[model samples]
Target: MKILKNIILISLFLTVSSCQKWLTVEPEDRSTEDQLFSSVNGFYIALNGIYTDFTNPYSYGAAWTMTTLEILAQRYNVNQEHTSYTLANYGFQEETAKRTMESIWNKAYFQIASANNILEQIEKRREIFTSPVDYALIKGEALALRAMIHFDLVRLFGPMPAQGGDNAAIPYYIENNRKTAPILSLNQVLSKAITDLENAIELLKEDPIISKGPLYSDSQLGGDYQRRYRTLRLNYFATLGLLARVQLYAGNKPSAFQHAATVITQASTWFPFIKTENIMGSSKNPDRIFSTEILFSLQAPQRQQTYLAYFAPDLDGKNILAPLSSRLDQSFENNQNDFRYTPLWASGEASGKNYRVFSKYNNIEDSRLNYNNRIPLIRLSEMYYIAAESAENPNEGLTFLNTIRNARGLVSLSELAPEQWKSEIEKEYIKEFYGEGQLFFFFKRIGKATIPDGKSVNNINMTPSKYIVPLPESETRHRN
Candidate 1:
C-alpha cells in the first residue's frame, strides 16, 4: 500500500503536468475563497502549497536552482561537456545561458506570487488572529518568503528605485500581477526584502509551534495524504535563516550578524548541527536536519534518484559517471589527505576499461525503488559559515571554520596572524562547503580571486558592479 502511495504521489508531483481543476484559481471564482483563508487552518494549507512549488526541479528545488547555478562555483560535480555553462564559464554570451539565469528569477517570483496570495488572504482575517503566536507565524512566513524571493532578484539584478514610477523597485509586488512588471534598482529591491524579513522576525519572535494547530502535520495517516505533507515542509527556523542570508547579502553586515546570531542564540534547540561523525553516515543518520537545520526545505519525490546521478557512482553503467581516476586525481594528488576522495570514490578496470564513480547517494531500498532523501535548503553548516563570515575578526571566523573542519576529520589551523589567517578563512570555506552553493556569491561578496574557465568570466575578480545580476528581459519589457 505504501508503495502504491509512493508511486501515485511521485507521478503527480515530479512532472510539469497540467493543473488539476481543484487546484486552479479563477479570478471570478470566489467559490472557495472563503475556505481558502477562512481560518488560520486554511491559511496554513495555502502556505504549504506555496512551499510545495519550491521543490519542483523547474523551480528552486535541488536539480535546478541549487545544482545548475552552482556548477562553476565549488560545491557541485560538473561533467566537462556542459557547454551551456561552459559558455558562461568561458565568458561566452548565449541566449540559453540567459534563459537558464532567468529561470531562477522567474521561479522565485512564482513562489512569491503564491506567497502573496496567502498573505492577501490572511490580511482579510487579521482580526481573527488572537495570539501573537498565530498572528506572527502566518505573517512571518509570508514576509520571509517575500524577502527571500526579492533578495534573489536583487542578487541577480542590481538595485531599483523604491518609488513606484518608472524608477521604482522591481514592482514591489505585494499584490500578485499576471502581467509583466517593471524592474527596480538593486538597492530598492533589497531594501524592501530587508524590511519584509525584519517584520517576519518580529512576528516569529513568539517562536510559533509548527507541528500542529492550524498547520498541517505529517500524520502517519497512510496514503497520498501522508506523502503530500511529509517531504516538503517549512517551519520558523527556515524563515529566520532566510532573513539572515538576505541581510548578509544586502551588505548590512551588522544586521546580518545579529539575525544569524539570534538564530544561533535562540533556535539552537531546534536546529543543532549534525555532529561530524553523523554527516558521513555514522550514528543514526538524521534526515539531513530537515526538522531543524532546514527551517524550510525544497522537496522532490525523486530527490534520491537525482542525487545519485551526480553524487553516486553509476555502478550499474560500468561506472560511467564520476569516474574513480578523476576523483582521486583531483582530491588526492600531491600527498593531500582528503579522505572524501579515497573512501567515497571507487576505481577499477573491468573488461579492459578504467571506470570511476561515487558512492555517496547510492544506497537503494530495492532493485526498482526510488530514493526519497529531502534536500537540505538551510543547514547548521551554512549558519556556522554565516556566523563566521559575519564576525569582525579572523580569530572569530576561524573558530567556526575549525568546528566544521575538525568534525570532518581534517586538521584544524591555529596560531596565525590576522593577515595570514584571512586566507585560511577562504580555504576553509571552499573546502568545507564545496558544491553547497556558496562559491559564486561568496566570491562576489568578499571580493575573491577570479578563475577564468574559458570565455565566460566566473568572478575572476570581485568587482562591486559584478555583485548583482542584470534585470530579466521580462522585467525590462515595459522600460523601453
Candidate 2:
C-alpha cells in the first residue's frame, strides 16, 4: 500500500497536455507543482482535472455519491440479490464495507491535496497567468473544490449538525504536506467551508462563461470558451447554490433559505425546470442528470455499462441493487400523474420480474441535449425546498412546496397546518431526490427516523447512531 503520508504530499498533476482532454486522467508526469503551473493553460488543465475525480468509481462517481447514499437512505429494497445488502444491513464493521469507505476517504483527501497544491502554485507563480481574471477563476474554483470535498467527508464521518457544535469531526488539510492537521469540531469545518465558498464566489463573479453565454475558441486567454459548460463545473452560481446546501447542513436555517432563494431567482435562466411538453414522449435524455433541473453535475463517461450492470434487466440475471415495488409505490404515494415517477422508476418486469430497478443514472445518447452520463449533485428543486422549510410563516413555506408539486404535474394543495410542514417537505424530498442520494442527509438534518421501508407503516425507526458511518480502518490503523 502507498504510504498515507506520502499520498497526501504530492499533486495529481499528470501528463497529456491537451485542454480538450481535461476530463480524462492520463497523467504522464508525477504531478509536481512546477510542471502543472508551467503556463496559463496548465492552470486550466489542473482545474478541470478536479472534476475528473468526481467520476472515479470509488468516490462521487458511484459509491459515495449515488449507490451507497441511496442504500443508507433505505431508498431501495434489501435482499441478498441486491448489491447493497451490506450497506442496508448496517454492516460498517465488515471488511468489504470498510474497504469501500476507505477508498472514498483516501480518494477525497488525494484531490484535496491537489487543490491545495494548485492554490499554492498559483500564488508562487502569480506572474505566469496572463491576466488577473484567470488567476482568480482558477484559485476560486480550487478553494471551493477543497471545501466541497472536506464538507462531504465531514458529513459522512462526523456527527450530525443537531448533535451540537462541539463534536469532533474530520481533519481539514489545507497544506500539501505529510503532516496531518488535527481534526476540528463539526462547527469548525462548516465555518471554514463557508469561508472558502465566500472567497470563491467573489472571484467566480468574473467567470467568462457567465458573460460569454457559451464557449468559443480563440487565440487569447479570455476568448477561449470551449470548456464553458458551467453546469458541469462549479461555476459562480453553482457555488452559491452549494453555499445554500452547506448553510442548511450547518443548521443556519435563515442563511440557507436566503442563499437558496437567490439561486432560484438568479440561476433560473441557466437551470430552468424541465418543461412538461419536452419531458413526455421524448427519446432524449433530459429527465436525468443531463436535464435543465441540474445546478451542479459530474461528467461520468463510460458509465452506461455500470448502469446496465446493476439496473439493466437483460444483462444481469443475478442483479444486486434494486428497491421493493411496495416501497417505490408508497414513495410516489400512488400519484400516477407525477412526472418524476414514470421516467425514474419503471417495473423490473420490463426486462425480468420482481423488484424496481433504478433508472436515474441511465446513460443516454442524445446529441440534442449533449447528454453523456453526467451525475447531478445539486438540483434547482432543492432550493425551493430549502426556502420552504426555512420559511417562518406556514403559508410562506407551503407556497414554495406547491411550486414544485405543480411542476411535477401533481395538483397543488392548499396551505396545511404549520406542524405538518416538516412531513410535507419530507414527502417532496423523497420524490425529488430518489436515486440522487439525498434522503440520508435529509434524515440526518432533521433527526428523522421511521424511514420508508418495504411498508410505510409499522417499520422500525432507523437507529440514530447509524446515521454516522465510522472512521475507516485505514485512518484508525495509521492515525497518531
Candidate 3:
C-alpha cells in the first residue's frame, strides 16, 4: 500500500466551547502520539476526527455523494465545457479525472490509516478507559470505519463479485505502520472487511442504542460526549446495515437477506418513515433527505455550501449539476405525490433556462432541526432494498420492496414474475438514492449492459471497462 507520511501521525484534538457537542476538531495540532493517547478523551477526539474527515469535498461531502460518483452514475447533464464532462463520459484516464480519482484514493486510505492507528493505540492504553462501553464504542467504530472505507475502495476499483472477484484488486490496510501492504484479490479484500465488521458487531453489543434506541443521549462518559447521536456514529445498527450492504455486494444473497432483515424487524421503530407532516405539511423546512430514516450519516456543517456549489439554480449551465427535467421526471415515474419527487426537487431558472434542481441538501432556515447538516450514508429504506433483492421468492421480495414504496407515498407493488423483480428493485434504487451515489454501484454490481442516459432519451451502453475505475497512477507507479 502507498501510505501518505502525514497520515501516519494521527494526532487530533477537539476545540469544543461547551459539553453539548463534540463534532469539531482542530487537526493542525502536532501533539505527540503518546500524549494524545494518554486518555479516553484523546481517543474520542481521534475517532471524531475520522468522521469529520469524511465530510471533505473530496470524499462524501461532495465527490462521493453529489459530484464525481453522481456524474459517473449519469445523474446529471454535464456539457462538454464543464469540468466534470470527462467524468460524465467515463473518461477515467483524462488528466483532471485522474486527479479526482487520486484524491479520493488518497483520502480514503488516509482515514483508514488514522482508524488503524486508533485500533492499535486503544489496546496499549486500555487502562485509560474506566468504562468498558467507552472502549468498545471507540474500538468498534474504528473497525467499522476501516471496513467501510475498504469496502467502498473495493466497489470502485475491484471487479463485481459475480464477474471476477478472484482477480486481484486493492490493498486492505490493517496496520498503522509504513510497510507496504500486499494487494489482495477482491474476494480476499471482502473477507477481510467482513471480518472487521463481524468484530465490530460483537464489540458494539454494549452500544446503548440497542436498549435506549438511536436517539438516546446522556451525560459524557469519561469526560467526552460520545454517547449522543448514536445514529450519526457507526453505532450498533449502522454497522449491521453496512454489513448487509457489503454482503449484498459480495453476492452472499442469503447472508445479506438475514442481516438486512434483522435491521428491518428490530430497528424499524428507531428509524420510522417520515411522517407526512414532516414533508408536505412543513413546507418551510421539509425533511427532504428523510433524516429520521438515516441509519448512519456524517454531521457535515458545510452541507449548504455543497448545495450552492453544485445544485443552486443560479449557476450557469456548465457549472450546475441539475439534470434534464424530463430525465428526472422519468426517474421518479412522473409521480407528483411521491415525497422524494416534489418536495426534494423544485423548478428554478438558471442561466435564463428553467430546470428541476435537486434540493435534498439545501439549507434549512432552522439550524436546530435534526436533519439540517446530516448527509446520510446508510438508511432504513436501503435495508428493505437489500432484503428485496436477496429474498428467496418474488412474493416476499415484493413485500419488502413495497414497504418503502408505501412510505414514500406510492402504492404497494403487486406480485411480479421472478424475472421482473430485479427491474422493480432497480427503479427504487434510482428514485430512492438520487444524489446519494449508489446508482452507479447498483448498475455495476448487476453488470447492467445499459442505463438511462441523463442527457437524452436513449440508454447509455456500458461494459466492464466503463464500470471499473482504474487505480490512480500514483499507486500504480509505486507498485511498479
lDDT of 3 by residue, 414-470 (tens): 778777888889999999998888999999889899998777778899988788899
Count of clashing pairs, candidate 2: 6
| Shift of residue 65 alpha carbon in model 2, Å | 2.8
lDDT of 1 by residue, 1-480 (tens): 000100001112334212121122222333365755666655655665666666666555643334554553433223355443442343313576567656666676667776777677677788776755666666777787777766655544543222221333355666654554445555667677778877776776655333331122333322323113321334455666677787676666677777676666666665555443444453233222322344455545565566565555433332133323433353333223543443343444442436444443333343222112445556555666677777777677778677766654677777567676546656655544433455555565555555333222232553443434555675565466
Arrange candidates, best TM-score first: 3, 2, 1
> Which of 1 and 2 is the better model by lDDT?
2
Least lDDT summed over 10 consecutive residues: which range in candidate 1?
1-10
Q: Is candidate 1 or candidate 2 better by TM-score?
A: 2
Question: 179 in model 3: Cα distance from truth in Å?
Answer: 1.2
Supply the TM-score for candidate 1.
0.72
CA displacement after TM-score superposition, residue 245 of candidate 3 (Å)? 0.7
What is each predicted model's overall lDDT from 0 to 1? 0.51, 0.73, 0.85
Query: Per-candidate TM vs. native?
Result: 0.72, 0.90, 0.95
- Model 1 gets an lDDT of 0.51
Residue-level lDDT of model 2, residues 219-309, one tens digit each, is 3345354246666677777788789899999989899989888887777776667887666656555455426777777766546656876
